[model samples]
Target: MFEEKRSILEPAGALSLAGAEAYCKYYGLKGANVVAVTSGANMNFDRLRLVTELADVGRRKEAVLATYLPESPGGFNRFCELMGGRSYVKDELLCRFVFPERPGALMKFLDALSPLWNISLFHYRAQGETGANVLVGIQVVDTEMDEFRDRANSLGYVYEVETRNEAFQLLMR
Candidate 1:
């Protein structure tokens, strides 16, 4: 009986009330323990809804922002203030770069981050075609936010953050 129930739950097998009962009986589990049960066509009908519900949970996914900024006076401080003002930012990841046209640009950016903030993670430089842009990606734990935009405004960097929900929806579609 246990074997029969296990077989019913198998992806290739048909699911039915009788099959589910056999499975429960074999496992010595009660019907209340079963969150859902389906057989054949019913399974197909339910699958998408289940997937949609699970996808909804992804909305709580951490937010990550990537920024491109130039090395300049007070630029870093303004960035920090923007992030600091937000109560939801969990951590910052810094990536620095100097355009091939300019030397020592990376060092200056790192120095900027040093005075008031701790870099949770850092990466530097792209392999080729050094542009004036430096990309930084930061993970935010909370969702209620807009301070990052203000921070970007202060720092003069174009920034974008993707919340988990947005990412999930994009992926689902």
Candidate 2:
């Protein structure tokens, strides 16, 4: 019999730790000490960048989300309200949004949200189409998640919360 009463096997790679943790959480495994073996002598800059990007997500220390907003007055304000009040260093939130590609869209988005939360990170990927992928990190309190949900729901644009997404953990954890 195995020496340990319980065992879990993880893939041997750069992201073994993140993957193992993700697997355990996905399977709802608990009450046992799990060991992970990660093998890598060195990592290149690209690999290092990728691993850093994914570390937070894999550890559930960040959330990835997408939202749609209208090009109308007060639309952006409502979205900011959904994220709760101003950031106070304690409420750090990570957010991503799919923005409609058009004149002043990016500026409007930032102008509205920056005043509410201390955005720690932002990434914009233009697809040369009608919409662009925008990743944002903000500071918000967990207790206000309900308000976040309500704001997103009524913001008049489609939105999705990707906090528990496996792809996020794998690609940017």
Question: Which candidate number maximizes lDDT?
Answer: 2
lDDT for each residue of candidate 2 in 1-173, tens digit (9 for 90 to 100): 01243222222364566667788999999976787676554655565445544555656866778899989999998998788834434455556677877788766665655565566767776544657777666666788667665554544434455545677546443
Tell me the whole-model lDDT of each prediction, alpha carbons only. 0.45, 0.61
lDDT of 2: 0.61
For model 2, the superposed segments whose C-alpha errors exceed 4 Å read 1-91, 147-157
Question: Taking the tens digit of each residue's C-alpha lDDT, what string does model 1 give over 65-109?
Answer: 589666998887688777764333355433333334357655554
Clashes of each: 2, 8
Give each model a TM-score.
Answer: 0.26, 0.40
